[model samples]
Target: MILETFKHFPDFELLDSGNGYRLERWGAYRLARPDPQAIWEHQLADAEWKKADAIFNSKWQVKTSVSQPWPIRFPLPLKAGEAKTGEWSIKLLARLSTFKHTGIFAEQAANWEWLTEQVQNTEFKAQKEQLKILNLFGYTGAATILLAKLGCFVTHVDASKPAITWAKENQIANNLPNDSIRWILDDAAKFVKRELKRGAKYDGILMDPPAFGHAPSGRTWKFAEDFPRLLADCTELLSTNAKFLLVNAYATNSSAIALQNLLEDSIKKTGTLESGELCLKQNSGRLISTGIFGRWSK
Candidate 1:
Protein backbone atom coordinates (compact mmCIF):
# COMPACT_ATOMS: atom_id res chain seq x y z
CA MET A 1 0.00 0.00 0.00
CA ILE A 2 1.15 3.55 -0.73
CA LEU A 3 1.53 6.13 2.04
CA GLU A 4 0.23 9.55 0.94
CA THR A 5 1.17 12.81 2.65
CA PHE A 6 0.04 16.34 2.01
CA LYS A 7 2.27 18.66 0.00
CA HIS A 8 2.23 22.44 -0.45
CA PHE A 9 0.60 22.65 2.96
CA PRO A 10 1.13 25.65 5.20
CA ASP A 11 -2.28 26.30 6.74
CA PHE A 12 -1.79 23.21 8.96
CA GLU A 13 1.27 21.64 10.52
CA LEU A 14 1.96 18.57 12.64
CA LEU A 15 4.57 19.85 15.08
CA ASP A 16 5.03 16.70 17.14
CA SER A 17 3.42 13.40 18.07
CA GLY A 18 4.22 11.31 21.14
CA ASN A 19 2.92 10.15 24.49
CA GLY A 20 -0.44 9.32 22.83
CA TYR A 21 -0.98 12.98 21.93
CA ARG A 22 -0.24 15.18 18.95
CA LEU A 23 0.80 18.81 18.97
CA GLU A 24 -0.36 20.76 15.93
CA ARG A 25 -0.47 24.30 14.61
CA TRP A 26 -3.67 25.34 12.84
CA GLY A 27 -3.17 28.67 11.12
CA ALA A 28 -2.60 31.09 13.99
CA TYR A 29 -3.53 28.85 16.92
CA ARG A 30 -1.85 25.77 18.35
CA LEU A 31 -3.65 22.72 19.72
CA ALA A 32 -2.80 19.39 21.24
CA ARG A 33 -5.06 16.35 21.11
CA PRO A 34 -5.03 12.60 21.68
CA ASP A 35 -3.53 10.55 18.89
CA PRO A 36 -3.80 6.78 19.06
CA GLN A 37 -1.20 6.31 16.31
CA ALA A 38 1.53 8.11 18.23
CA ILE A 39 2.59 5.22 20.43
CA TRP A 40 6.19 6.38 20.93
CA GLU A 41 8.24 8.76 23.00
CA HIS A 42 7.76 12.45 22.34
CA GLN A 43 10.36 14.42 20.49
CA LEU A 44 9.21 17.78 21.80
CA ALA A 45 9.48 18.81 25.44
CA ASP A 46 6.39 18.44 27.66
CA ALA A 47 6.49 22.17 28.38
CA GLU A 48 6.20 22.88 24.66
CA TRP A 49 3.25 20.58 24.40
CA LYS A 50 1.66 22.26 27.41
CA LYS A 51 1.68 25.63 25.63
CA ALA A 52 -1.08 24.65 23.26
CA ASP A 53 -3.88 27.19 22.86
CA ALA A 54 -6.40 24.38 23.12
CA ILE A 55 -5.79 20.92 24.56
CA PHE A 56 -8.24 18.05 24.51
CA ASN A 57 -7.99 15.30 27.09
CA SER A 58 -11.45 13.71 27.29
CA LYS A 59 -12.70 17.34 27.11
CA TRP A 60 -11.28 20.58 25.80
CA GLN A 61 -8.95 22.43 28.19
CA VAL A 62 -8.74 25.95 26.89
CA LYS A 63 -5.73 28.09 27.62
CA THR A 64 -5.37 31.13 25.41
CA SER A 65 -8.46 33.00 24.32
CA VAL A 66 -9.28 32.29 20.67
CA SER A 67 -12.07 33.02 18.27
CA GLN A 68 -15.07 30.66 18.28
CA PRO A 69 -14.33 29.79 14.67
CA TRP A 70 -11.12 30.71 12.88
CA PRO A 71 -10.42 30.78 9.18
CA ILE A 72 -7.91 28.41 7.55
CA ARG A 73 -7.10 28.43 3.88
CA PHE A 74 -5.92 25.46 1.80
CA PRO A 75 -4.08 26.22 -1.45
CA LEU A 76 -4.74 23.59 -4.10
CA PRO A 77 -2.36 24.10 -7.04
CA LEU A 78 -3.34 22.30 -10.17
CA LYS A 79 -0.87 19.78 -11.54
CA ALA A 80 0.64 20.06 -15.03
CA GLY A 81 -1.45 19.15 -18.11
CA GLU A 82 -4.75 20.33 -16.68
CA ALA A 83 -6.93 22.79 -18.59
CA LYS A 84 -6.46 25.17 -15.71
CA THR A 85 -2.95 25.71 -14.35
CA GLY A 86 -3.39 28.03 -11.37
CA GLU A 87 -3.96 26.98 -7.77
CA TRP A 88 -7.35 27.37 -6.07
CA SER A 89 -7.94 28.29 -2.47
CA ILE A 90 -10.35 26.38 -0.17
CA LYS A 91 -11.41 28.44 2.82
CA LEU A 92 -12.86 26.64 5.86
CA LEU A 93 -13.84 27.30 9.45
CA ALA A 94 -11.96 25.58 12.27
CA ARG A 95 -13.76 24.78 15.50
CA LEU A 96 -12.96 22.30 18.25
CA SER A 97 -15.49 19.51 18.46
CA THR A 98 -16.67 17.64 21.56
CA PHE A 99 -15.17 14.51 19.98
CA LYS A 100 -11.70 16.07 19.46
CA HIS A 101 -12.02 17.14 15.82
CA THR A 102 -11.06 20.49 14.24
CA GLY A 103 -13.62 20.16 11.37
CA ILE A 104 -10.78 19.59 8.93
CA PHE A 105 -8.94 16.43 7.92
CA ALA A 106 -5.65 17.92 6.66
CA GLU A 107 -4.29 14.49 5.76
CA GLN A 108 -6.81 14.23 2.92
CA ALA A 109 -5.16 17.14 1.10
CA ALA A 110 -3.41 14.70 -1.22
CA ASN A 111 -6.69 13.20 -2.30
CA TRP A 112 -8.15 16.68 -2.73
CA GLU A 113 -5.39 17.46 -5.21
CA TRP A 114 -6.15 14.25 -7.06
CA LEU A 115 -9.80 15.24 -7.18
CA THR A 116 -8.81 18.59 -8.67
CA GLU A 117 -6.88 16.84 -11.41
CA GLN A 118 -9.80 14.55 -12.17
CA VAL A 119 -12.00 17.59 -12.64
CA GLN A 120 -9.62 19.68 -14.71
CA ASN A 121 -8.10 16.88 -16.79
CA THR A 122 -11.01 14.51 -17.30
CA GLU A 123 -11.45 12.99 -20.76
CA PHE A 124 -15.15 13.75 -20.37
CA LYS A 125 -14.62 17.43 -19.61
CA ALA A 126 -15.26 18.50 -23.19
CA GLN A 127 -18.37 16.38 -23.46
CA LYS A 128 -19.61 17.21 -19.98
CA GLU A 129 -19.14 20.82 -18.95
CA GLN A 130 -20.26 20.40 -15.40
CA LEU A 131 -19.26 17.07 -13.86
CA LYS A 132 -21.76 16.00 -11.23
CA ILE A 133 -20.50 14.60 -7.91
CA LEU A 134 -22.13 12.91 -4.91
CA ASN A 135 -20.30 13.47 -1.63
CA LEU A 136 -21.57 11.29 1.23
CA PHE A 137 -20.52 11.96 4.79
CA GLY A 138 -19.23 15.21 3.39
CA TYR A 139 -17.88 16.83 6.52
CA THR A 140 -17.24 20.57 6.45
CA GLY A 141 -17.42 20.79 2.62
CA ALA A 142 -13.71 21.03 1.90
CA ALA A 143 -13.89 18.68 -1.06
CA THR A 144 -17.35 19.90 -1.95
CA ILE A 145 -16.14 23.47 -2.40
CA LEU A 146 -13.12 22.32 -4.34
CA LEU A 147 -15.25 20.53 -6.93
CA ALA A 148 -17.83 23.32 -7.09
CA LYS A 149 -15.21 26.02 -7.65
CA LEU A 150 -13.92 23.95 -10.54
CA GLY A 151 -17.32 24.15 -12.28
CA CYS A 152 -18.92 20.98 -10.95
CA PHE A 153 -22.34 20.73 -9.34
CA VAL A 154 -21.98 18.78 -6.09
CA THR A 155 -24.57 17.15 -3.84
CA HIS A 156 -23.12 17.12 -0.32
CA VAL A 157 -24.74 14.74 2.20
CA ASP A 158 -23.99 14.46 5.90
CA ALA A 159 -25.79 13.09 8.93
CA SER A 160 -24.93 16.02 11.23
CA LYS A 161 -26.90 19.19 10.86
CA PRO A 162 -24.16 21.22 12.47
CA ALA A 163 -21.61 19.89 10.00
CA ILE A 164 -23.81 20.85 7.08
CA THR A 165 -24.33 24.27 8.63
CA TRP A 166 -20.61 24.74 9.13
CA ALA A 167 -19.97 23.67 5.54
CA LYS A 168 -22.50 26.19 4.32
CA GLU A 169 -20.76 28.87 6.34
CA ASN A 170 -17.52 27.97 4.63
CA GLN A 171 -19.21 28.20 1.24
CA ILE A 172 -20.51 31.70 1.86
CA ALA A 173 -17.17 32.68 3.40
CA ASN A 174 -15.53 31.77 0.10
CA ASN A 175 -18.13 33.64 -2.02
CA LEU A 176 -18.83 30.62 -4.23
CA PRO A 177 -21.86 30.38 -6.47
CA ASN A 178 -24.96 29.51 -4.47
CA ASP A 179 -26.19 27.07 -7.10
CA SER A 180 -22.97 25.04 -7.12
CA ILE A 181 -23.78 22.84 -4.10
CA ARG A 182 -26.88 20.99 -2.97
CA TRP A 183 -26.81 20.20 0.75
CA ILE A 184 -28.63 17.16 2.15
CA LEU A 185 -28.87 16.18 5.79
CA ASP A 186 -29.87 12.55 6.05
CA ASP A 187 -28.58 9.03 6.60
CA ALA A 188 -26.10 8.21 3.81
CA ALA A 189 -27.38 4.70 3.13
CA LYS A 190 -31.02 5.73 3.08
CA PHE A 191 -30.31 8.70 0.82
CA VAL A 192 -28.31 6.54 -1.56
CA LYS A 193 -31.19 4.05 -1.76
CA ARG A 194 -33.53 6.86 -2.72
CA GLU A 195 -31.13 8.19 -5.36
CA LEU A 196 -30.80 4.71 -6.89
CA LYS A 197 -34.55 4.34 -7.08
CA ARG A 198 -34.79 7.72 -8.83
CA GLY A 199 -32.18 6.50 -11.37
CA ALA A 200 -29.84 9.31 -10.41
CA LYS A 201 -26.27 9.20 -11.65
CA TYR A 202 -23.05 10.86 -10.57
CA ASP A 203 -19.72 11.13 -12.35
CA GLY A 204 -17.86 10.80 -9.06
CA ILE A 205 -18.77 9.51 -5.58
CA LEU A 206 -16.81 10.04 -2.35
CA MET A 207 -17.42 9.19 1.31
CA ASP A 208 -15.55 9.38 4.61
CA PRO A 209 -17.56 7.36 7.12
CA PRO A 210 -17.04 7.30 10.85
CA ALA A 211 -16.71 3.98 12.66
CA PHE A 212 -20.21 4.52 13.96
CA GLY A 213 -22.73 7.21 13.08
CA HIS A 214 -26.26 8.30 14.03
CA ALA A 215 -28.69 9.91 11.63
CA PRO A 216 -31.36 12.52 12.26
CA SER A 217 -33.98 9.84 11.55
CA GLY A 218 -32.70 7.74 14.48
CA ARG A 219 -30.92 5.38 12.10
CA THR A 220 -27.50 4.19 13.22
CA TRP A 221 -24.58 3.40 10.94
CA LYS A 222 -22.21 0.58 11.80
CA PHE A 223 -19.34 0.38 9.36
CA ALA A 224 -18.76 -3.34 9.57
CA GLU A 225 -22.41 -4.20 9.15
CA ASP A 226 -23.59 -1.42 6.82
CA PHE A 227 -20.59 -0.52 4.59
CA PRO A 228 -20.56 -3.56 2.27
CA ARG A 229 -24.16 -3.11 1.21
CA LEU A 230 -23.66 0.64 0.89
CA LEU A 231 -20.66 0.13 -1.38
CA ALA A 232 -22.67 -2.22 -3.59
CA ASP A 233 -25.42 0.37 -3.85
CA CYS A 234 -22.96 3.20 -4.52
CA THR A 235 -21.49 1.32 -7.47
CA GLU A 236 -24.91 0.95 -9.04
CA LEU A 237 -25.48 4.71 -8.70
CA LEU A 238 -22.35 5.51 -10.68
CA SER A 239 -22.95 6.65 -14.24
CA THR A 240 -21.86 4.28 -17.00
CA ASN A 241 -19.15 6.78 -17.88
CA ALA A 242 -18.21 7.46 -14.29
CA LYS A 243 -14.85 9.05 -13.63
CA PHE A 244 -14.02 8.00 -10.06
CA LEU A 245 -15.02 6.60 -6.66
CA LEU A 246 -13.22 7.34 -3.38
CA VAL A 247 -13.75 5.80 0.08
CA ASN A 248 -12.01 6.98 3.26
CA ALA A 249 -12.19 5.08 6.56
CA TYR A 250 -10.89 5.99 9.99
CA ALA A 251 -10.61 4.11 13.33
CA THR A 252 -11.59 0.84 11.71
CA ASN A 253 -10.31 -2.72 12.16
CA SER A 254 -10.40 -3.26 8.40
CA SER A 255 -7.32 -2.60 6.27
CA ALA A 256 -7.02 -0.55 3.06
CA ILE A 257 -6.57 -3.79 1.15
CA ALA A 258 -9.89 -4.97 2.52
CA LEU A 259 -11.56 -1.84 1.08
CA GLN A 260 -9.89 -2.54 -2.26
CA ASN A 261 -11.19 -6.10 -2.15
CA LEU A 262 -14.73 -4.93 -1.49
CA LEU A 263 -14.50 -2.43 -4.36
CA GLU A 264 -13.22 -5.19 -6.59
CA ASP A 265 -16.28 -7.25 -5.74
CA SER A 266 -18.65 -4.29 -5.97
CA ILE A 267 -17.59 -2.19 -8.97
CA LYS A 268 -18.60 -3.51 -12.38
CA LYS A 269 -16.65 -0.90 -14.32
CA THR A 270 -13.00 -1.62 -15.14
CA GLY A 271 -10.69 1.08 -13.79
CA THR A 272 -7.40 1.79 -12.06
CA LEU A 273 -7.61 0.88 -8.37
CA GLU A 274 -5.29 1.91 -5.50
CA SER A 275 -5.37 1.70 -1.71
CA GLY A 276 -3.13 3.23 0.95
CA GLU A 277 -2.76 5.01 4.26
CA LEU A 278 -3.01 8.80 4.63
CA CYS A 279 -0.48 10.42 6.95
CA LEU A 280 0.81 13.75 8.23
CA LYS A 281 4.48 14.61 8.64
CA GLN A 282 5.81 16.14 11.84
CA ASN A 283 8.54 18.76 12.00
CA SER A 284 10.90 16.09 13.35
CA GLY A 285 10.46 14.05 10.11
CA ARG A 286 8.25 11.38 11.69
CA LEU A 287 4.88 10.54 10.13
CA ILE A 288 1.60 10.15 12.03
CA SER A 289 -0.64 7.80 10.08
CA THR A 290 -4.23 8.95 10.36
CA GLY A 291 -6.51 6.85 8.10
CA ILE A 292 -6.81 4.52 5.14
CA PHE A 293 -8.42 5.03 1.70
CA GLY A 294 -9.33 3.04 -1.39
CA ARG A 295 -9.74 5.07 -4.62
CA TRP A 296 -10.65 4.03 -8.13
CA SER A 297 -10.43 6.21 -11.26
CA LYS A 298 -10.84 5.71 -14.98
Candidate 2:
Protein backbone atom coordinates (compact mmCIF):
# COMPACT_ATOMS: atom_id res chain seq x y z
CA MET A 1 0.00 0.00 0.00
CA ILE A 2 3.03 2.28 0.18
CA LEU A 3 4.07 1.99 -3.45
CA GLU A 4 3.18 3.25 -6.90
CA THR A 5 -0.41 2.98 -8.09
CA PHE A 6 0.89 2.01 -11.55
CA LYS A 7 3.11 -1.04 -12.01
CA HIS A 8 3.96 -3.58 -14.64
CA PHE A 9 5.56 -6.96 -15.31
CA PRO A 10 9.29 -6.47 -15.49
CA ASP A 11 9.60 -9.45 -17.81
CA PHE A 12 7.23 -7.91 -20.33
CA GLU A 13 7.37 -4.62 -22.26
CA LEU A 14 4.85 -2.65 -24.23
CA LEU A 15 6.89 -1.50 -27.19
CA ASP A 16 4.41 0.62 -29.11
CA SER A 17 0.72 1.18 -29.71
CA GLY A 18 -1.79 2.74 -32.06
CA ASN A 19 -4.54 1.84 -34.47
CA GLY A 20 -6.32 -0.25 -31.88
CA TYR A 21 -3.24 -2.43 -31.39
CA ARG A 22 -0.33 -2.77 -29.01
CA LEU A 23 3.06 -4.21 -29.80
CA GLU A 24 4.63 -6.04 -26.90
CA ARG A 25 7.73 -8.00 -26.10
CA TRP A 26 7.09 -11.04 -23.92
CA GLY A 27 10.40 -12.51 -22.96
CA ALA A 28 12.10 -12.79 -26.37
CA TYR A 29 9.18 -12.81 -28.73
CA ARG A 30 7.49 -9.66 -30.01
CA LEU A 31 3.76 -9.69 -30.49
CA ALA A 32 1.16 -7.29 -31.81
CA ARG A 33 -2.23 -7.68 -30.25
CA PRO A 34 -5.47 -5.77 -30.37
CA ASP A 35 -6.04 -3.33 -27.51
CA PRO A 36 -9.03 -1.11 -26.96
CA GLN A 37 -6.84 1.44 -25.18
CA ALA A 38 -4.72 2.11 -28.24
CA ILE A 39 -6.94 4.75 -29.76
CA TRP A 40 -4.25 7.20 -30.89
CA GLU A 41 -2.00 7.19 -33.92
CA HIS A 42 0.89 4.78 -34.31
CA GLN A 43 4.00 5.75 -32.42
CA LEU A 44 6.41 3.39 -34.19
CA ALA A 45 7.19 3.01 -37.84
CA ASP A 46 5.73 0.23 -39.95
CA ALA A 47 9.25 -1.13 -40.48
CA GLU A 48 9.67 -1.46 -36.75
CA TRP A 49 6.29 -3.12 -36.41
CA LYS A 50 7.21 -5.59 -39.16
CA LYS A 51 9.61 -7.35 -36.78
CA ALA A 52 6.84 -8.83 -34.66
CA ASP A 53 7.18 -12.57 -34.25
CA ALA A 54 3.44 -12.83 -34.21
CA ILE A 55 0.59 -10.49 -35.08
CA PHE A 56 -2.96 -11.15 -34.06
CA ASN A 57 -5.93 -10.24 -36.23
CA SER A 58 -8.39 -12.72 -34.79
CA LYS A 59 -5.49 -15.20 -35.18
CA TRP A 60 -1.72 -15.32 -35.17
CA GLN A 61 0.46 -14.52 -38.16
CA VAL A 62 4.09 -15.33 -37.85
CA LYS A 63 7.13 -15.72 -40.09
CA THR A 64 8.04 -19.22 -39.00
CA SER A 65 6.60 -22.17 -37.18
CA VAL A 66 6.30 -21.08 -33.55
CA SER A 67 7.03 -23.10 -30.49
CA GLN A 68 4.15 -24.31 -28.34
CA PRO A 69 5.28 -23.04 -24.96
CA TRP A 70 7.93 -20.70 -23.58
CA PRO A 71 9.00 -19.54 -20.17
CA ILE A 72 8.68 -16.04 -18.70
CA ARG A 73 10.53 -15.96 -15.44
CA PHE A 74 10.00 -13.42 -12.64
CA PRO A 75 12.71 -13.14 -10.04
CA LEU A 76 11.51 -13.48 -6.48
CA PRO A 77 13.00 -11.85 -3.43
CA LEU A 78 15.65 -14.17 -2.08
CA LYS A 79 14.29 -15.90 0.99
CA ALA A 80 16.14 -16.47 4.22
CA GLY A 81 18.40 -19.34 3.19
CA GLU A 82 21.88 -20.78 3.04
CA ALA A 83 22.76 -20.12 -0.58
CA LYS A 84 23.97 -16.67 -1.65
CA THR A 85 24.15 -17.04 -5.40
CA GLY A 86 20.88 -18.85 -6.02
CA GLU A 87 17.82 -16.60 -6.12
CA TRP A 88 14.20 -17.75 -5.99
CA SER A 89 12.10 -17.28 -9.10
CA ILE A 90 8.90 -18.52 -10.75
CA LYS A 91 8.20 -19.01 -14.42
CA LEU A 92 4.91 -18.90 -16.32
CA LEU A 93 4.51 -21.03 -19.40
CA ALA A 94 3.74 -18.80 -22.37
CA ARG A 95 1.86 -20.08 -25.38
CA LEU A 96 -0.09 -18.56 -28.24
CA SER A 97 -3.71 -19.51 -27.92
CA THR A 98 -6.74 -19.09 -30.16
CA PHE A 99 -7.93 -16.27 -27.91
CA LYS A 100 -4.61 -14.43 -28.45
CA HIS A 101 -3.24 -14.95 -24.96
CA THR A 102 0.18 -16.13 -23.87
CA GLY A 103 -1.23 -17.84 -20.72
CA ILE A 104 -0.40 -14.88 -18.44
CA PHE A 105 -1.94 -11.50 -17.79
CA ALA A 106 1.02 -9.14 -17.83
CA GLU A 107 -0.82 -6.36 -15.99
CA GLN A 108 -1.47 -8.58 -12.95
CA ALA A 109 2.25 -8.75 -12.21
CA ALA A 110 1.92 -5.75 -9.89
CA ASN A 111 -0.99 -7.19 -7.93
CA TRP A 112 0.94 -10.42 -7.49
CA GLU A 113 3.86 -8.50 -6.07
CA TRP A 114 1.64 -6.36 -3.90
CA LEU A 115 -0.28 -9.35 -2.56
CA THR A 116 2.97 -10.99 -1.52
CA GLU A 117 4.11 -7.85 0.21
CA GLN A 118 0.83 -7.49 2.09
CA VAL A 119 0.88 -11.10 3.23
CA GLN A 120 4.49 -10.85 4.31
CA ASN A 121 3.82 -7.74 6.32
CA THR A 122 0.59 -9.00 7.85
CA GLU A 123 1.95 -12.41 8.83
CA PHE A 124 4.48 -10.68 11.12
CA LYS A 125 5.96 -13.12 13.67
CA ALA A 126 2.56 -14.12 14.97
CA GLN A 127 1.50 -16.49 12.20
CA LYS A 128 3.87 -19.36 11.60
CA GLU A 129 1.87 -21.86 9.62
CA GLN A 130 1.40 -21.69 5.88
CA LEU A 131 -1.43 -19.27 5.01
CA LYS A 132 -4.41 -20.66 3.18
CA ILE A 133 -5.25 -18.51 0.13
CA LEU A 134 -8.23 -18.77 -2.20
CA ASN A 135 -7.80 -17.78 -5.82
CA LEU A 136 -11.07 -17.49 -7.69
CA PHE A 137 -11.26 -17.17 -11.46
CA GLY A 138 -7.70 -18.35 -11.34
CA TYR A 139 -6.69 -18.38 -14.96
CA THR A 140 -3.24 -19.71 -15.80
CA GLY A 141 -2.14 -19.37 -12.15
CA ALA A 142 0.50 -16.69 -12.21
CA ALA A 143 -0.33 -15.45 -8.72
CA THR A 144 -1.10 -19.00 -7.64
CA ILE A 145 2.40 -20.23 -8.46
CA LEU A 146 4.08 -17.10 -7.17
CA LEU A 147 2.28 -17.24 -3.82
CA ALA A 148 2.63 -21.02 -3.47
CA LYS A 149 6.35 -20.55 -4.00
CA LEU A 150 6.30 -18.43 -0.86
CA GLY A 151 4.93 -21.53 0.96
CA CYS A 152 1.23 -20.63 0.94
CA PHE A 153 -1.31 -23.38 0.40
CA VAL A 154 -3.53 -22.08 -2.40
CA THR A 155 -6.92 -23.29 -3.54
CA HIS A 156 -7.28 -22.32 -7.19
CA VAL A 157 -10.86 -22.38 -8.52
CA ASP A 158 -11.84 -21.96 -12.14
CA ALA A 159 -14.52 -23.30 -14.42
CA SER A 160 -12.34 -24.03 -17.39
CA LYS A 161 -10.66 -27.43 -17.41
CA PRO A 162 -7.98 -26.25 -19.83
CA ALA A 163 -7.10 -23.38 -17.51
CA ILE A 164 -6.74 -25.68 -14.53
CA THR A 165 -4.53 -28.03 -16.55
CA TRP A 166 -2.35 -25.15 -17.67
CA ALA A 167 -2.14 -23.90 -14.10
CA LYS A 168 -1.04 -27.36 -13.00
CA GLU A 169 1.68 -27.30 -15.64
CA ASN A 170 2.78 -23.94 -14.29
CA GLN A 171 2.86 -25.41 -10.79
CA ILE A 172 5.12 -28.21 -12.00
CA ALA A 173 7.22 -25.70 -13.89
CA ASN A 174 7.94 -24.00 -10.57
CA ASN A 175 8.82 -27.33 -8.92
CA LEU A 176 6.50 -26.56 -6.01
CA PRO A 177 5.40 -29.38 -3.73
CA ASN A 178 2.42 -31.40 -4.93
CA ASP A 179 0.35 -30.37 -1.92
CA SER A 180 1.11 -26.71 -2.35
CA ILE A 181 -1.89 -25.93 -4.54
CA ARG A 182 -5.40 -27.38 -4.59
CA TRP A 183 -6.72 -27.24 -8.13
CA ILE A 184 -10.52 -26.96 -8.24
CA LEU A 185 -12.26 -26.91 -11.59
CA ASP A 186 -15.61 -25.44 -10.67
CA ASP A 187 -17.54 -22.25 -11.23
CA ALA A 188 -16.09 -19.55 -9.00
CA ALA A 189 -19.31 -18.31 -7.38
CA LYS A 190 -20.62 -21.84 -6.95
CA PHE A 191 -17.32 -22.94 -5.47
CA VAL A 192 -17.27 -20.01 -3.08
CA LYS A 193 -20.79 -20.78 -1.92
CA ARG A 194 -19.81 -24.38 -1.34
CA GLU A 195 -16.77 -23.28 0.66
CA LEU A 196 -19.01 -21.03 2.74
CA LYS A 197 -21.38 -23.95 3.36
CA ARG A 198 -18.43 -26.12 4.34
CA GLY A 199 -17.41 -23.42 6.85
CA ALA A 200 -14.08 -23.08 5.09
CA LYS A 201 -12.08 -19.95 5.63
CA TYR A 202 -9.09 -18.44 3.87
CA ASP A 203 -6.30 -16.25 5.14
CA GLY A 204 -6.44 -14.38 1.85
CA ILE A 205 -8.54 -14.26 -1.32
CA LEU A 206 -7.94 -12.84 -4.82
CA MET A 207 -10.04 -12.81 -7.94
CA ASP A 208 -9.80 -11.48 -11.50
CA PRO A 209 -13.25 -11.83 -12.92
CA PRO A 210 -14.20 -11.42 -16.55
CA ALA A 211 -16.50 -8.70 -17.82
CA PHE A 212 -18.85 -11.41 -19.00
CA GLY A 213 -18.62 -15.16 -19.11
CA HIS A 214 -20.37 -18.47 -18.70
CA ALA A 215 -19.49 -21.07 -16.12
CA PRO A 216 -18.74 -24.58 -17.29
CA SER A 217 -22.27 -25.44 -16.18
CA GLY A 218 -23.72 -22.68 -18.38
CA ARG A 219 -24.35 -20.22 -15.56
CA THR A 220 -23.72 -16.66 -16.65
CA TRP A 221 -21.40 -14.28 -14.85
CA LYS A 222 -22.24 -10.70 -15.72
CA PHE A 223 -19.93 -8.29 -14.00
CA ALA A 224 -22.63 -5.76 -13.17
CA GLU A 225 -24.98 -8.33 -11.66
CA ASP A 226 -22.72 -10.97 -10.11
CA PHE A 227 -19.69 -9.14 -8.67
CA PRO A 228 -21.40 -7.71 -5.59
CA ARG A 229 -22.92 -11.07 -4.67
CA LEU A 230 -19.55 -12.74 -5.06
CA LEU A 231 -17.92 -10.10 -2.90
CA ALA A 232 -20.52 -10.57 -0.18
CA ASP A 233 -19.84 -14.30 -0.20
CA CYS A 234 -16.08 -13.76 -0.12
CA THR A 235 -16.32 -11.44 2.86
CA GLU A 236 -17.82 -14.25 4.92
CA LEU A 237 -15.16 -16.72 3.75
CA LEU A 238 -12.15 -14.70 4.94
CA SER A 239 -10.29 -15.47 8.13
CA THR A 240 -10.74 -12.89 10.89
CA ASN A 241 -7.20 -11.65 10.47
CA ALA A 242 -7.49 -12.03 6.70
CA LYS A 243 -4.10 -11.10 5.42
CA PHE A 244 -5.31 -9.93 2.03
CA LEU A 245 -8.12 -9.65 -0.50
CA LEU A 246 -7.56 -8.43 -4.07
CA VAL A 247 -10.13 -7.79 -6.78
CA ASN A 248 -9.21 -6.96 -10.39
CA ALA A 249 -11.81 -6.04 -12.94
CA TYR A 250 -12.01 -4.90 -16.56
CA ALA A 251 -15.69 -4.02 -16.56
CA THR A 252 -16.58 -1.09 -18.81
CA ASN A 253 -17.91 1.20 -16.08
CA SER A 254 -15.39 0.66 -13.29
CA SER A 255 -12.80 2.99 -11.83
CA ALA A 256 -10.42 2.70 -8.91
CA ILE A 257 -12.93 4.62 -6.78
CA ALA A 258 -15.71 2.18 -7.63
CA LEU A 259 -13.53 -0.78 -6.70
CA GLN A 260 -12.58 0.88 -3.44
CA ASN A 261 -16.20 1.57 -2.63
CA LEU A 262 -17.22 -2.03 -3.34
CA LEU A 263 -14.50 -3.43 -1.06
CA GLU A 264 -15.31 -0.93 1.69
CA ASP A 265 -18.98 -1.83 1.56
CA SER A 266 -18.55 -5.60 1.45
CA ILE A 267 -16.28 -6.36 4.40
CA LYS A 268 -16.69 -4.99 7.91
CA LYS A 269 -13.06 -5.60 8.84
CA THR A 270 -10.67 -2.72 9.37
CA GLY A 271 -7.63 -2.90 7.15
CA THR A 272 -5.62 -0.94 4.61
CA LEU A 273 -7.64 -0.55 1.43
CA GLU A 274 -5.91 0.68 -1.74
CA SER A 275 -7.18 0.87 -5.27
CA GLY A 276 -5.80 1.97 -8.61
CA GLU A 277 -5.63 1.28 -12.31
CA LEU A 278 -3.67 -1.63 -13.66
CA CYS A 279 -1.33 -0.23 -16.28
CA LEU A 280 1.52 -1.13 -18.60
CA LYS A 281 4.39 1.29 -19.11
CA GLN A 282 5.66 1.48 -22.62
CA ASN A 283 9.32 1.90 -23.53
CA SER A 284 8.61 5.55 -24.34
CA GLY A 285 7.57 6.28 -20.78
CA ARG A 286 3.85 6.13 -21.47
CA LEU A 287 1.33 4.15 -19.50
CA ILE A 288 -1.68 2.31 -20.92
CA SER A 289 -4.43 1.73 -18.42
CA THR A 290 -5.79 -1.79 -18.62
CA GLY A 291 -8.07 -2.37 -15.64
CA ILE A 292 -8.96 -1.28 -12.13
CA PHE A 293 -8.05 -3.03 -8.88
CA GLY A 294 -8.77 -2.79 -5.16
CA ARG A 295 -7.03 -4.64 -2.36
CA TRP A 296 -7.38 -4.97 1.41
CA SER A 297 -4.89 -6.24 3.95
CA LYS A 298 -4.34 -6.40 7.67
Query: What's the TM-score of every candidate structure?
Result: 0.94, 0.93
On residues 1-298, what C-alpha lDDT tens digit does candidate 2 reach at each position? Answer: 2223325356688899899999998888889999977899888899988989999999988865567798998867643543646656789999998778889888788887787676656543354777899999998899999989877899999899999999999999889989999999888999999999999999999999989988999998998889999999999999876788999987548777888888999988987888888877778877788888888887
lDDT of 1 by residue, 92-115 (tens): 889988789999998988888778
- Supply candidate 2's per-residue lDDT for 219: 91
Q: What TM-score would candidate 2 get against the native?
A: 0.93
- Residue pairs with backbone atoms closer than 3 Å in model 1 (clashes): none
Question: Using lDDT as the measure, which candidate wins?
Answer: 1
